[model samples]
Target: MDSPNTLAVRIEPMTVDDLPQVLEIERVAFPSPWSARAYEYELRYNDMAHYFVAWLDAWALRHPANDGVIGWLRRWVRPAPTVGAPLMVGYVGYWLMAGEAHVSTIAVRPEHRGHSYGELLLAHTLQDAARHGAHVATLEVRVSNTAAQQLYLKYGFDKVGMRKAYYSDNDEDALIMTTPPLNSGQYQEKLRRLQIALTMQLNTQMGRKLSLVSRTGA
Candidate 1:
């Protein structure tokens, strides 16, 4: 944890308003990025789609502490009025339909990648998919992305197959991975334990003394 007072990072349903930040990350992280119009269509017209954004809490960015009377006024009289938008650090998207969930994409800003915010997003996605009656979840990651493969394996996803030339930009093969049935007790218990550890990591790294909101709005 860099600072004990750092605000919580939150994941919430992605809306049209989040496209700009989301696209910015996509462009930087991948050779080919989905366009804003594609994202808008997913948000507005794709009934099977589920997407989310992770943003930092707005408090400290808007009210960086002062050492004198103004700081005193903020602490004792009234909290400094929050200004500006909370930083959007990451996002994830997937599709759920007919008992299956397919992860479409996920990325964290390069600067924010090490803080476990990406793990937080992945955990939330699986849990949310299960709630919506998805029995299994799957995704395809570039064969070269060992870090991502390890992360997925940590959560019970197994490499089940391969997709030849799955990535359009470079014709890179993708490892197809799938989880055991999400509704099964074994899988659920594993996810529950992981969720606990993930929450602790997020709290430890991002600070969650307060302002941890519900999944929908966080």
Candidate 2:
């Protein structure tokens, strides 16, 4: 429940228009973040890269009590309208080459952390990657980030190797994590169950339904 924080989120392929908000979260999420140009190249020219963004649905976040008769009356008694586009709460990107997909980056906005939004992004993006033909998935996380390691492990990733001084900002070694062949029956069952659990968890906090959605990369 992440401290009873109600949330509703959508996952979609990152469009060029999402960069502004993406960068806003990126700047504070890492010690040495990728520059705008870097993201631009990935979205615009990198054919192997597939990226997705998670939006916090403003309409979904509105109080459920503001509905039907109560909502209709509230409009006249105390009018408050849900407006504007859903905001980008986080993003995840990965590069797929041959049969391998490498999780490049993932982050959530500071205020939106601890709600499993990062896990949502990771799970959805990884599913997308598999759908697009990723046989295996891999990622590198800071050795000190036990939290991230735990999450990866929960998703069937295991520590396979390491790269010394992987983070330029801190010279911290990175633990290389990789998942089993994504098409394995065991993995399929695991992913299916986890996704179902995630949906139930999300709806529990959302106060409403927020279904998963994705799009093909350009």
Candidate 3:
């Protein structure tokens, strides 16, 4: 059952058209964001890269701003050209190589942070990876990010090793985490249980319910 406030959210392949909003999120989410050129290369040339964007369908019309500068602008631009479409909220990127899926980056908008959106993105990525013939999924996180580490642990990722001074900006160590074979029954069952729990959490905390839909077939 979906909550009344639930929004239609979908994850789709990242296209060049999505870079504008994706860049905005990238700038705010990371201390060292990837350059637009880098993203362009991945989208255009890197066959191994699979990036996705999460969109809140018809979000603008459903929650219109009737007051403030944004409202005034909306009035000024009467008969707004764009309406009734999904607005990109967050993104996830991964590279599939040699039977492994490496999660390069994932982030949600700052204002949209506390709603279990990140978990949703991660779950989608892992499921997508499994469907695409990946045996394992892995990622690296700043050692100091315990909250994120905890979330990864909850998703069946384990700290297998550490990288020395992996972060360029602060020269911080990164914790290397990897999941067991995603195609295995054990891992799939674990993911299924987590997905069920996540659905409950998002429904309760965000006033909105959502579900995962895999493009490549999960």
Number of the top lDDT candidate: 3
Tens digits of per-residue lDDT, candidate 2, 1-218, equal 21224454668888778898898889989888888899999889999999999887556435565568967886676444356457787999999988999999999977567768899888887788888889999999999999999999999999999999999998999999999989888998999899888778767766556555655455
- Full-model lDDT for every candidate: 0.81, 0.81, 0.82
The residue pairs that clash in candidate 1, if any, are none
Q: Report model 2's TM-score to 2 decimal places.
A: 0.84
Root mean square deviation (Cα) for candidate 1:
7.0
- Estimate, for each residue in 139-187, the C-alpha lDDT of model 3 and write its tens digit: 9999999999999999999999999999999999999999999999999
lDDT of 2: 0.81
Return the TM-score for candidate 1, rounded to 2 decimals. Answer: 0.82
Q: Which stretches of candidate 2 lie over 4 Å from their true place?
A: 1-8, 60-82
Clashes of each: 0, 0, 0
- Which residue pairs collide, candidate 2? none
- lDDT head-to-head 2 vs 3, winner: 3
Candidate 3, residue 126: lDDT: 96
Residue lDDT tens for model 1, 1-218: 32336565667899998888899889998899999999999999999999988877655434334346766765575443355457887899899878899999999987557777788788889988988889999999999999999999999999999999999989999999999999899999999999788777765654444344437522
